[model samples]
Target: MTQNPPIRRALLPATALLAALALAGCSGGGSVRVAAPVTTGSTAEQCAALKAALPATLQGRKLRDTTPESANTAAWGNPAITLRCGVGTAAVLDPHSPAYDLNADIEESGGVCWVSEQTAGGGFRFTTVRQQATVELTLPAAYAGGQSPVGLLAGAVLKADPVVRDRPFACV
Candidate 1:
């Protein structure tokens, strides 16, 4: 065995530290920054549960830790698909508003209900209309094909939060 010189040993530690710091950051997909979501205590608590339930990877992409990270939000992939919780639910599922997404498009699977739609720019926007807290998901246009993150998140929400289904007369 050969012993390294004194200078070489000191340089090795510095090199290792830099490598470790680099790995702690968001992957090459890039770190997506957004304002920290605002929520009431009850909603924050629900979001906390959802945050804990989020997987390290979704749609086969590594999770990206957002700037000003919070329990109310989550992200995955290079372009970064983000999920925001504690949103307000609709009073009624509308059919005419530009932001309106039909309940008819909602799909329930793995104990979670999802309403997903493609935007004009070709990206996808999805939201949970029937869960305890409204969780909104956004996927960039670059990632047009992949397994949906809906089921994975649904499982997590089911475990951490309450199941909520739309009612005929209740708020959407």
Candidate 2:
């Protein structure tokens, strides 16, 4: 009677185990969904024009330039207390950017500030680039002043509108 070789049997199981380990290691970890900044126009004047066109709820907000991490953590339509909670959860999802300043400034006044992305340095290394945008929001009004403006804006923006646009980028 013919019998299988021990070395061949060992190799098969070892190969399978190695393959499984490789697959597990390849999977990315701590992936969070983040919104990308947008460019509506050029120059501060154009910025003002763009701001004017945003939904009325966002009109009163300020304008500032900051990082992508800062972009997704602002308050959109409510007070600081609620905004703080939203920011905490939102930051976990958005990606961080070092190029732009992620700006937000009061356009008209009344506890409001418009936050978005501004064009800055370009070209970098990344496995893939993702495109995301801030959209409509519903905030709680009032925020603790100690927080950075960027964080405030991103969280506020998300709270203002939970829904937004998303895209992907592959840096070559």
Candidate 3:
């Protein structure tokens, strides 16, 4: 029976480890997983416009593809900052809800009103308030400490689905 020399055996394990790491890196760069929002009629049209208006890069992160692609979804970066248009208004926005706190929770950026919520994973989710159709943006925990990127999305939201004058909420 033939046996590998000590040096050859050592190199074999090192080579295997390098190959595994390379594969992992490649997988990480693949498409981001995002649940596309469902839109209909006018809302669908609005989302399409918003998708087109979304910046090619967000917070210095270049845009990346999303799985099961749809016109209402977009993503960027390895940790993935994701956006979904034409979503239903967040339940927390309701005045009657116990979690509602207009003064404390609402934030205004680029003339748009937003409400932010911390996710279980320590990330943050910001959603537009009082717009024709809600748009949600999520930032991974890696972004928890930096300046908010909600402002970066304001232009596209305003251009595609400006706030509805009749809606109850407004950025003050």
Top candidate (TM-score): 3
**Candidate ordering by TM-score (highest first):** 3, 1, 2
lDDT of 2 by residue, 1-172 (tens): 6557987787899999888888754642222223433333222233233233333334344333222433232223222111111121122124563332223221211222233222133211111112123232222223322323333334333333332224321112
Off by over 4 Å in 3: 1-27, 95-104
Weakest 10 consecutive residues, lDDT, candidate 1? 163-172
- lDDT winner: 3
Task: Give the lowest summed-lDDT range of ten residues in model 3.
Answer: 95-104
Give the alpha carbon lDDT tens digit for every residue of 67-118 in model 3.
Answer: 8799989999878999888887765786677866655477899989988888
- TM-score winner between candidates 1 and 3: 3
TM-score, predicted candidate 1 vs. hidden true structure? 0.72
Model with the higher lDDT, candidate 1 or 2: 1
Clashes of each: 1, 47, 0
In order, the Cα lDDT scores of the candidates are 0.73, 0.30, 0.86
Per-residue lDDT for 82-116 in model 1, tens only? 88888765423555555663444677757776667
